[model samples]
Target: MNDTYSNGKDVIRITDVKLTTVQTRRRTGAISSHIVLQLSTDAGITGVGEISDLDCYRMYMPDPAAVKMGIEKVALGQNAFEIAALHERLLAYMPSYFRYANTYPPFTPASQIAAGVEMAFYDIVGKAFGTPVYNLLGGRQRDRFEITYPVFQAKKESDTERYLGYMDALVAEGVTRFRYYVGVNFEQDENFLIAFRDRFGDKVQLKALDFQGHHHWKDVLRIYDRFRQYGFELLESPSWREDYEGMAELRKRVDVDISEHISSLAQAMRMIRAGAVDVFNITIQSGGIYQAKKLFDLAEAAGLKSLISTTQEMSIGTAANAHLGAVVPQLHYAGDPVGPLLYVDDVVTEKLRYDGTQLIVPQGPGLGFEIDEDKLAALQAGLVEWDRPAHGANYVSD
Candidate 1:
């Protein structure tokens, strides 16, 4: 039955689902691969979403052609606005499960397949309600939010110069907040910190992300003490992600705030209850916009601050970050939403514009950007190879 909802809006059933592979240099400085997801409704309304994944999951149907066919099988005839239902349905039928640390969310699709599907639902629902996506998630607290530029550590000299140049360019563009990966060399990390202090002075807000738990819990204090005088902002994933006791103790001892990416809302509750985190950092990768909103609400209830973390998602995924930023009341816009800033190219017709350090959240319906069909075609046609940089040195290597 293709009937209208009781709210007086016409029911828009998802009639088609399509996914495509695009080749581009992602924010992590890899000429990698990403999937663009599109959902078409019976009423002719179309929604867009995108996803990128590392080698974390090996699909039985690795070919995009086959996956697109599978998506249609799972999505066709379903209500486009039933976000949670759609998310659960997609994950309930994945060919592979999320294969990361044991502490992360379980029963999730390994790749960005679930993210793309979830984003599509948000787009359809927002368009259906004639409001921005964040409006559908209990309204927004801010009209705009801030994002940080990520500095990826590289071993090549040219890559080093390029990243430094990228930093300088961002500073010229009025970016005032930055996050640098804390590499293995403490002295080198300290050198980068000193140079950053000398270059940007106190005008810049800096955060140290140990994507790899490089330091033992006892020794972590040693490193923190050395940089404590500089007023280093935050330390993330220092020694172990699931070491809640260590993280809690560090929170009690150090001058720095601690944060790490968690897998599930239940785990977030556990982390909050254990007093393990100063800032609740969750990515859009796990459950897309709907679940991300739930996580923020949980953080708010627990009296903990929350922020959206990105794995350098492309335009659609990054736009999802801004949508989340606008609505999450407890968020400070302190996390990284540097997808457009990191990518050499994007699929959106209108590229995102930054107002100094802040990313201007698009106010239009759905994810606030239109797809560039020609650009999509060009990227799909130019597919040469796909690569993802390792996540961090200590925990999981990509």
Candidate 2:
């Protein structure tokens, strides 16, 4: 055993919790913002966690300010290891909306807050025990895993060449797995698909064509039918999240796999019952690593595959995803924890290791990440003008 645990100083107590807001520019011309959580313990360990800003396109309202206020109310002075108890209290404090299909809200703000809290506690415990966060979850299932590189949808038809060139550069760099974003305009999507097929052929694995629940079932079917020959692996969230029956019908009409975002057990049950989803795109942003592991088990029992979804988090959040990936066996598909590579820069002192297209599971204690204080300070300064209110007007008026 390690000296930290053997000396009976193992009872790490949470003394303080701090939140630092930071934003980094993504390659897609969008800013990836996060509220970084720092849990200072009596044992002289500071556990790090990340809460991604999700106020995009006005689709969902995420309350990071509430997370800031509630973290102290729920987590201060608690034993760092009592994560389960803390989680229950946090859920009770920030209750989910239960009005829709007996399912948790598709994007529960509390879950985002809770995810950050859970991450910090796990980091504390892992450090106290002198082990990687993955060991706490179960044990390492794989040393490394592939991350599906996403090519965000072009802004307009004229930008198609630039997008294709981006793919070409990645392909040349030995990236074999990919996911393409669509749903801007069907014409651009179709033309891009045609160009992609003509250029790359079947040389690269098109892991998914993500619609992000942006299209109707019929429209999705038309795209699927036309691009069936292109051989993308799955159709991701073809319709709006609550339309289980429509998703089921679309699943029946297509031969490819269907994936949907799942937050709670009730939502997964609803999808499974309706045969709406073949793969669960489980994001830790919903409920953190422990809850994600449970979802993976549920998916496995239902004989469904799963992939870890991403909100394009920075190094800290990406490291959390890597630890989760290390333990979950049902995460057979190439996940989207590509944020470490997608951002122009990261705040970590040591970035997570990558081998060609694969991300190496971080081996250091406590989520295997250390924040660069200087970079974080600089990032926080720049985030002054990048508030959530500015993002509220990002959508079309139509």
- lDDT values of the candidates? 0.69, 0.76
> Least accurate stretch of 10 residues (summed lDDT) in model 1?
98-107
Residue 264 C-alpha lDDT in model 2: 80
Q: Candidate 1 lDDT (Cα, whole model)?
A: 0.69
Count clashing residue pairs in model 1: 1
User: TM-score for every candidate vs. truth?
Assistant: 0.86, 0.91
Candidate 1 deviant stretches above 4 angstroms = 1-9, 26-29, 53-66, 94-111, 154-161, 381-398
lDDT of 1 by residue, 263-382 (tens): 576667667887988787767776677666677777788877777887667778888888888877767537777777777887789877678877888778788777899998888732
Worst 10 residues of 2 by lDDT: 97-106
Runs in model 2 deviating more than 4 A are 5-10, 53-66, 97-106, 381-398
Q: Which candidate leads the pack in TM-score? A: 2
lDDT of 2 by residue, 267-359 (tens): 888888998988998878777787777788999999998998877677778888888888887666788888877777778897777777899
